[model samples]
Target: MLALAALPLGVRVTVLEPDEHAPARLCARHLHAPYTDPAALNELAACDAVTLEFENVPVEALAALQDRVPVRPGGALLARSKHRAHEKRALQGAGATTAPFEAIEADTDLPGALARVGGRGILKTSELGYDGKGQARVNSDAELRAAWENLGRVPCVLEGLVSFEREVSLAVARTPAGQVAFGPLVENVHRDGILRSSVFPAQVPDGTEARARELARAVADAWALEGLITLEFFQLPGGDLIVNEVAPRVHNSGHLTQDGGGVSQFEAQVRAVLNLPLSDWRPLHPTAMVNVVGVDGPDGSPLTPDWAAIDALDGTRVHLYHKAHRHGRKVGHVNLVAPDPGTLRARLASLEPLIP
Candidate 1:
């Protein structure tokens, strides 16, 4: 919602978030904030079009809106994206490399299914999981059983963990005219499996960026996706790329696009949904982003950020999601730009200690 509000030109943007007062369906375990409430459904339903910020939205709700508005990346992508096992299967079927995985229903052949994907693995709920939640690492049946217990013993899929050199992602958008453009590969740094920062101009081999973009386009076309799609991959120790996950909406990794791309992710999605020409996804700066999670002050109140220092950095842009401050919640982000790597690193280092 914040990103869409930053479009470079005047464009109408309407976001349909689940009602804050709705039954609180345990949609994704984490959502920073919503742009509106349920009463606005009529208003949203009357909009020219709609785009999703994440993939966990209920298909039923989207279907309800379909008769009244154009929903980009409609039901097909949503159905495939909601299930982990199905998403990986789609990637492999599309001739994209992916980690080995198995699907398991809480009531069916649980033991044998777990055995199929042998050794230490990551277990994720088939539905309603994101940002390190609804997932657990299992090294044995005990761990698997415990994960089931922790995850409320829901239907889930288990995937063998990829021992990769690093993680990188490509963001691509397809226009109504079938034109496609890709942003450069983003080098991601994860803290305990949750994304902590993203660096543009991924420090990889000469051909890596090209290959990543090609693969991302392939995956998007495979799903017949028509809007923004984010494909995350792991560079294996042998220099091979394996698809780790696919997000059918705007992504955290694309945040740098705001200050460093010809078209920001938000505007690109808008264009794709509106069937406008896709812009070049080239880098506009050597930039990096750090998530501003809610931190407690010494007195136990929500820490009041020094927005002055954050906005003062050269080529820096900050976004603060209007969410109630809570521990570990992603309340906002800080982006910094520099002429070279040295300045970028120094800027990040300078902001790290002060964030908390």
Candidate 2:
């Protein structure tokens, strides 16, 4: 998507992806090899400026390229983001509040750690966990131990659950020159631990928006953020925000901005990385987005989308990822815009059937 957005600017892209079938291949030069492959890293170093669009890229590989070209939101931030414990520290250091958590370094630490988090918490691997994987919700000490054992006894963080009324996300893009443009507080919905939908103009209590804005700016300043950072939060009943997780890249929650009649996150990222001017972050209309989760058929092909039903709908735009489908994978998303929130909700509710 970044490549797609960059095309109009006459910017050439070179993608470093291990997957031969990576979607970016269609739009950019595809270097197909392991991320740690020294040869691939060397080739990537020749680009004018590099930006990481995903987490889990080895920070060492990025560090190697820093001497040759600019790496926005570079190695230090990636190192902090790759581990959950370090991520929480980064959040707190940026003066943002996060959920209570205890680090689990050994089996003996489980009982004490669980008790510290109010005797019940979600145990997540310190590294490489997403979409409900590498984490378990445990209600007992034995369950906590079992969960840790199930994760291969790796270093983990047990975070106590909070009683929050809603989940919201804030995304900000910053340039190396220090200009910042913030996407609005996006109201998000998740089911089975995956993002389902996002709505703009998050209806929060008065003053919540200002605090979220402050946190986004502080984190960007603290990290010396060069591209984009998305901060997902748990919005409490009274509108206080608690950090749920942070992603130092374009995120699922911000997909709605593509059709928001304003500067899309993808384009903002391109402009930020290239040191181009950024527009203000306000949109012209109410917008919403829904993810198209893949549900494969008997022979392992994705279930065909209901085009007839989709065509029957109006005022919605569909974007497909064009990757091989696997059960529970995100294959595409649909966006809808309306003059008001109520109309957008009704139109989005009608899209649910077409996805399944």
Candidate 3:
């Protein structure tokens, strides 16, 4: 849905999606087909350039499109970000700090790997995991075996848990011509591994924000990145930051940019991919973006909340995805802007009951 912001920039969008009812299709022309279908590839090749909404796209499909049309951030970056092991290495190669991790290809290796991470760690699948899915927190040998079995005994990475003060993210945009822009650092709150809310102008020690900006710029330069890139970080108690994960597309944490920052992340991506000049992004106000997760009905459809209550709130803008709600799905979000962080938090609290 955020991608719709690019439309006003005078760019026509053609979304190639398998799901006819995907939210973004509501605002743009959509070609319904699987991403890996040859016919779909042919259709995508007609576009001037292509960018992805998410990073888990099939590498084979991207590789096929690369020869036919430009795919921003390219297949190499996509492949690297899709797998946990590869992403860790990429961050290290970029000279970014990351948690200690080891690969576990078999259930038997779980015990030894756990010991290496100090007997407690997060075991994540090497591929296809998001929002706390395909992950397990194991502290014992029995839990380790269960985690391995739960993940289908696939290749996995065991990461030592770090004692961090907070979780924050930086959204950076770069153009083919090497121009770069960054959205404000955002402090994220998560529940069950799914992002619950993003608070802009994150409350951190002095110099933390500058460090994050520097890190983000370095990562963007290292990847020769084009379009939007978000880097998640863990702020240690001592005020140091470590790379947590990288998302090579518009990020949920950046949704606040729509109202707080002078330009939205989506528009920045459009500018980057089109090789247009980026705006001087600045925060217009303190903002809070809260995700509206869905609840399953008895028939397994999404049960929506009272829109009137949400719309009645002052300084709040509600965006609902045109999708049938399924349990735990991100059906929409509410972006609230205020004069300061305290006002933003209060506004968020008032609207909490309206979100499923």
Q: What's the ranking of the predictions by TM-score, best on top?
A: 2, 3, 1
lDDT of 1 at 129: 83
lDDT of each: 0.75, 0.87, 0.85
- Per residue, candidate 3 scores C-alpha lDDT tens digits across 1-356 of 54587778777888878887766677788788888989878888998888988877788889999778888878888888888889899889988899989888965676577778877889999998898889999898788888888889999998988889999998888888899888788999999899999987798888888898898888888888988788999999867999999998889988877877588888888888888998646468998898988777788767777788888888888777777766787878899898988988888888777876
Pairs that collide in candidate 3 are 302-325
Model 1, position 51: C-alpha lDDT score: 70
Q: After superposition, how far is residue 312 of candidate 3 from its true place, in Å?
A: 2.2
Candidate 1 local lDDT, 212-289, one digit each (tens): 877888887887778888889998765679999888887898888777746677677777877887776756778888
Best of the candidates, lDDT:
2
Best by TM-score: 2
lDDT of 2 by residue, 76-173 (tens): 88889889999999889999999889999886787678778887799999998887788999998889989999999999999998999899998888
Q: What's the distance in Å from true for residue 29, model 1?
A: 26
The weakest ten consecutive residues by lDDT in model 1 span 22-31
- CA RMSD, predictions in order: 4.6, 1.5, 1.8
Pairs of colliding residues, candidate 2: none
